[model samples]
Target: MATMQECPRSPEAKLGMRVEDLWDIQEAQLSPTEKLNACFESIPVSAFPLPSSNQEVEIKSDATLSEAVKILAHHNILSAPVVNVDAPEDASWIDRYIGIVEFAGIVVWILHQSEPASPKSPSTPTSATAIAAAANGNTFALELEALGLGSASTTSGNFFEDLTSSELYKNTKVRDISGTFRWAPFLALERSNSFLTMLLLLSKYKMKSVPVVDLGAGRIDNIITQAAVIHMVAECAGLQWFENWGTKKLSDVGLPLVSPKQIIKVYEDEPVLQAFKVMRKEKVGGVPVIKSGSNTPVGNISLRDVQFLLTAPEIYHDYRAITVKDFMTAVSSYLEKNKTAFSMSCEFVTCKMDCTVKELIQLLDREKIHRVYVVDNNGDLEGLISLRDIISRLVDEPRGYFGDFFDGVLPLPANSRV
Candidate 1:
């Protein structure tokens, strides 16, 4: 049988190579030939399959907000697909992929819809009626239904025609951390700044992340986070102080830094399926997309985006050819149009350099963004804050699993170093 060393590097090459060719290769050094069949059998395409979306409840874009909420609540689904029944001629009718409507979005909308039209005087009753009166004449169920269906149902049954005529895509200021670029500003120690101080800032502002830049260097250095600080403190106290005494620097106790090479970029015009395949194969959560000419990041496509897409298979098939440009919300469009990014008003938060790691973690937890960006004073891109980075710093190795294994292990002879 072929030994481990006899395995071929390429399956295709193995299929074409003769048994004599394998036996003749000195590097393989196969003493037995029976194992060759076993290695070759493992090379089929079944070894890899495309990643797929997890089964979750789906809702039509035109469904009433009340209906959407009910479905989501019942199914425990966090988001749903919004479909445009009447898509363009080039588009497939069944392919009605619209953006997602998340539970958070629904909650925010409900809060706004339920608010009273006028402020109640001290004498106003605190009962349901008083509360309903204050809601500026907006009804939660009605508004939900209205927004759910788009405008066509109101004027006529031709919802797609009306939607198409009036810019089916609405620009809204969805919260994006990339916007709040700032340079490294000195945060005074007198501000009672500590890891906790920074943590509070992040949480209060609902930021996904904050950057730490060295003022003197004029470049981003390292990010600090609540998770990192906590883990470092725990490791110092638990390991170095009591067990392993010589390890120094946070890096020794934390996960290795992820180099930029680890990050993958995709074009905005690529098919969603292609992006989906890459992410699944790589086991990555998100990818940055750059415009055709600009190296600057235009937007991000994430797992959540795929989840929204899967809710409507028809839309997915139709837009399989669509690029990121077809759906991406531009920064300029966001600032000028009074439109929310992609028609949603998500909060955008950022922090200046010199912010502590503790602060960044708080922002991540509160904002619920998977990643955050660090920027310069002019809002130029600097670095990024990611959940993996935080977790790596925070996770601890269990104690005593290899106890005494390293105690007094013999040092190698000076001249006999292997």
Candidate 2:
């Protein structure tokens, strides 16, 4: 009776019994996928970045490649929808919406430019009219690179020397690379589409961001991202589910999820372009750099590292001769030289196969990275996990969440960085 007379409560506990009852009701939902989807729909499209009246982030098709890079870096955006300036005055707003210029697309342009000019088939000078036509054709090829719609080469030569030497990277118009919305196609989703529909579209298309078109409103209103999906699942799904999933070792997590054909890795001594090629072909953001003749991971490279090329054009000037080491070293040097002035770390995050999945997610959240490389007992490369992989798994294996609560505790509280 005396103990029951007084009890202390923390600030969060200060809420009335009704509040706790409401939380219990919300958490009682047993269908994880349905609960996750409901949570996603509850979030407005505006939760992520949306175009403003100024639309300052939109890239103009007429802008130069250099300008496009600057805009992306300056705004900390990975891609932007290319808007057509030359659309017929009377054209519908949707018609002016062209393809997107992703940072990965810029990597393609860089790799292409780094290649030595293939010896042009010997040709004679032509009439001015004919020269103009050929110039237009060349422009079309450059535009293809701009749209990130080129294939990797089996031939061992640089393919972009002509484009670079002509000062096209610095002067070529973005519209030329915008390609047609018909060729590359502006894949869009409606604002009213279900959360499952958006997730399916992202997974099927392997897109980082898909524009949400409010057609009835006649506007490309907002965007949905893999990150958004991850966040929703993490928040709505019970913490017990995350803890249970996290307790499983990474080896079990990655190997079963990634097929052999999906594994993309590069060697330490290989040309950086090789890694970029793998990224482009596989549509991955990063690749583990390993030792030759072995899977032992030595380092990793990502599109974030590629962005450095835009800042230091000189390093890219020797793009063809530079190996992956040279590029990594340059990035290290740049970061080291500026570390005193900026809060940045160049270290690549890696995890052993024995580590728990929760540990991997914690590292991803802590480092603000998209993917983490999984290594074997010998420190050899094993597999990788990305935000997309996590989101896809949640949708495909919602039943995985039905299990006993984990007694193991997290080293740190979950912070939804991704």
Candidate 3:
């Protein structure tokens, strides 16, 4: 693991520094105070405009299951914000932000509602069997425009209507509702850090695109995606050693800023099922929720969390009967009980803000953990690092050649003997 050192502040020492000046300047390179002040700063949101609201797709809360599906499909969306059709336009119906109904939710509902006796014989199919089979087909292929229940037959309507037409059109009342899903509490970095530090931090965090904030003005600047980081690093490496030997701050590079509103979010108290639904529908990794209007983030729920809950029989059973409060484990609890009470192998990993990327990677690899919480010296979470961050950086890179020589046989040049 890399060691931390203090930075030199003497003006005479830094006046005409060169790349070689940094080789023995480990103390100055790793000082948290120096790096923190130099590398980390907040960018304002105004620079990056908030994402425009998605065009609302209105659906009656009581619409037939088929109608709901049609609306989702027609809009080419994964979920449609629901509303009460009978309510007046200015009724402040915002309180009625009833949870979104997503394709995943619909699938789960259908799977649960399916009768066990309907398909005992695999060879001999029944009406329920056919419906199940069709619904189980490539869900991704179903056009986004063909998601709502209203246009069931026009796309997959015959399958839905044939199975549950009577219950859908007659018993379900269509209410008016409209809304879009969002993810939030996103962190953006400025271009002041070295390509190496950016690579290290990004690999540690498992982020796709980190929004860049302008430290000077405290506003969103641009975005630094995994691709951007890799390209920048590759370019830096190609420079002569004299040109690229020293550490570079984040701002030295030119990364644009992104706004907080561009991030998606959900309430902390929301059902985990709803989180899963939105993730599936929007095709995002996770959602960040605030503790209310405060900028302090409560917690983030990701697709991996949902998958873990679903795959664990005990967890899934408990989830069916319990609320989010019942399952949520406070982050503080994990830190307080580290190593002694909580076995490193089975438990999550965490680190302080001062931890280096090399240290984080070793810990993650050794413990086989997916993510680690980054805390301050006081142990309060500052951010999170995950395998996704590492993998994202490697996405477009070419694989090395070690695998081709696994047998220990070496290929000789065309004109030479083995």
Candidate 4:
């Protein structure tokens, strides 16, 4: 969270290096950023370095949510490309895959199942404070009835049990939940595609990982992820161009594009289930946590955090009494005790409003996190930033900079975020 003093940024400061200069300037005379842009434009996906030995885990289409969670947790990845379980030998690349399954998708499915189908059906269950309320002999429910703040007709009793033990969790396959998340695109990057296209796919299109499928071989070579992109940026530490832009304070870059009021956060006292629901509905990877009645952030929780409930239910004694605060405390202690590298970012990651982009980059790379919160002098939350925010700042308009990057791809749905 090391930061610079708050300062004003010139209104006319350039958003990105000029693209035309990349094409016209002599290689020796070009500025570092201009040269870097040209280099990225010329490099194809095929030229990117090989994935680490432990990476590239894929989930079969038939894998149940339970099985998928184990695979991801076992590999410690956030998402996996799902191969077609019944594809013929000569199938097209698209035909050979159903879609990528993500931790976020599973959470969405579990939340959907908790919806009360009918008045006669069991009430939708809850976790953290909701479950704690239920555990107290329905006293909260009775009080709600007396106060008219809640009613038996709406979400009355324990609606969802332990998430992993729920019927839907055991029975549902990865294929069955394809429609659960609004942003689950199965797009694959071709070997011939440019690096800028990959960046835009990850940053602009909100792709968590772009599967690199070799159509000629009909096999995946590697998955390009935001972490990989950040790692590359981190490696450019000594480069003059990176330092030029990276040295600028976050205020100069202006990311986390949304204002404080636009942020989707959960109070520590609220039910943890509500945190997951709002995250799914809002299409955010992680949600920030605010101390009740205060702007300060106590922690940050991600959709991927559910791996605990999925793979290691033993971590929490009473899953029902787990409030968002309790969830954070248990997770932080567990990670520290075991020192597992499973998103050390989820516990408590915050920064000052004037943190340098370079500082943010190193923090994310070191902590293995996707997002970080920005707080004020009082450590009160100001905004939440992510890998996407950093990459998005690298270019002005991706669509215009990378010509025809979307050619022959399926058209984006009209409702997609522009």
Q: What TM-score would each prediction reach against the true structure?
A: 0.33, 0.67, 0.31, 0.78
How do the residues 1-418 of candidate 2 rate in per-residue lDDT, one tens digit apiece?
1221133132212221222233335555456445445454443444343433325368888888878877886776667778788777555546767667866676564444333323362132222223323535555444434433233322122333333334656777777644411125456766655455566556644667777876765556776666644443333222443554556776554433663346787877777757776776566678877778876777778876766655554544545455676678777877787655333355777776677766655566555567777666677666677777765654442343323322331222131111
Candidate 3 lDDT over residue span 143-163, tens digit each: 221323222113221332333
- Native-referenced Cα lDDT, model 4: 0.67
Cα error of candidate 1 at position 347, Å: 7.5
Q: Give the Cα lDDT of each candidate.
A: 0.38, 0.56, 0.39, 0.67
Candidate 2 total steric clashes? 5
Candidate 1 lDDT, tens digit per residue, 1-418? 2431256433322332332343344344432222332232223322211112224344555565445545654554455444444555345322333334554443233233322335564233333334433432334234333433311112222322222222211212112101111101212111112332333333332222233333343322333433333333222222211122223332343322343355676777665445644664465556777566655566666654532332222332333234555434432233245433232222334444555545555565555456655545755445555665554443222344234533553343332101
Lowest summed lDDT across 10 adjacent residues in model 4 is found at: 4-13
Question: Clashes in model 2: which pairs?
Answer: 61-175, 112-160, 115-158, 116-158, 143-177
lDDT: which candidate is best?
4
Residue-pair clashes per candidate, as listed?
A: 39, 5, 62, 5
Model 3 scores a C-alpha lDDT of 0.39
lDDT of 2 at 54: 29
